[model samples]
Target: MAATEITLEVARYRPGVDSEPVLQSYQVPLREHWAILDGLTYVKDHLDGTLSFRWSCRMGICGSCGMTVNGEPQLSCATFLTDYAPGPIRVEPLHNFPVVRDLVVDIDDFMTKLPKVKPWVIREVQSPIEEGEYLQTPEEMDECQQFSMCINCMLCYSACPVYSLEPDFLGPAAIALAQRYNLDSRDEGADERRDVLSSPEGIWACTFVGECSAVCPKGVDPAGAIQRYKLTAATQSIKELLMPRSLIPRSKG
Candidate 1:
């Protein structure tokens, strides 16, 4: 196999000028170890300076380089160029989001939806100034630690058919974050959180497409968190109907 010379068929769009996106090709030199991000960088530096994409930390940790490589959600940094190279490789911004420019999509919609989920540990009460930290056993942290790896890349949203079909769906990352708080022993917002989870745009929109889990670079199984949230939500609903007292979260007092 040749080490260099691979064609990248990149999607191009200038928002106000173009009706829709179009493909433009660029020839980039590839090494077996070179990531797709490097290929895009080469194309941008040499050929098309207008091509846009997001990348940070060149390591896979940032998740900013997420995009669709040949119709599949992937981290450009993690995806090797030679893996798909005999010739042209199709690259585009993540699907199910509005394109801001060529291959750059606007993630403001996701950022807007995230805060509504209350993705934080709500302490029952503020600790004293002398208090140092909230300690957790290994088991306690392990219960929900895996969900915290999300880098907010929106690849899961891109892979999610539900988010694409229903624009209002709360989506994988937010749901995963919601689960993150729900599982934390320090959080006390479980009952208050139901309004977001039970609404039309919430968990019901998901059809278990599981593409979010499959495409996750950090192995954060959003599908599993969503399922657990559904289960917890159902149990809460049942308890509220029967016991009534359980509908309200226990107060720290």
Candidate 2:
């Protein structure tokens, strides 16, 4: 027999009132189709209207509903409540970030670090509007396609042990997004992004624990992206040492 009700132990925090977060339990209907987000919604609507969390789209595309579900970083909308079965389901804010209220975390650090990598195409001179859009072949698009799937959900950051230990680490999503723009044939920003990506806080900070890729709901292999960039950075360093600056071809952006 399947249990109809399940206890959701959701973390609760209210600034200026609560010094720290506390787990508040709520009994919710455990339908087969009920996701963790659905249970949370039910709790908010019926049990406690003061319970706070961030969720949008509710379909996993918005990446706004990311939270720690049973010790794993996951999108609440995609994590079914029935999977946990007959008991309490632990739900909390993503790790390595300051909890704003309950499930909502402060993403100010990620937002600040993202722009440092210049995750955009760089062109020394803009082409005239009449020149039309920059074209890319299938092969060219494939180079950066895998890395471009990141939606900035910050799940990778939550799963990364390095980010937890070192708050200044550039983090998995930001590094992978940098690789996305770097590998894009239409983008010439690789040279511009190299300084940040090769810095102490960037790819070097990642110890290849690979939890970032494991927690990613978008199937983006951020660990692999970091490895790829490390190789590229290393190769560039070798060339710079062996070849004269004038002799080495400059990257045309």
Q: Indicate which candidate wins on TM-score.
A: 2
Return the lDDT, model 1, position 214: 94
Residue 96, model 2: lDDT of 93
| Every model's TM-score | 0.94, 0.96
lDDT for each of the candidates? 0.86, 0.91
lDDT of 1 by residue, 64-108 (tens): 888899999999999998899686899998999999998889898
lDDT of 2 by residue, 1-253 (tens): 7778999999999999999999999999989899999999999999999999899998888888899999999999999987898779999999999999988899999999999999888876889989999899999899889888888899999999999999999999999999888888888778888899999999998899999999999988999999988888887789999987577665422
Task: Give me the displacement of residue 168 in model 1, in angstroms.
Answer: 0.9
Which candidate should be chosen as best, given lDDT against the real structure?
2
* Clash pairs, model 1 backbone: none
TM-score, cand. 1 vs. native: 0.94
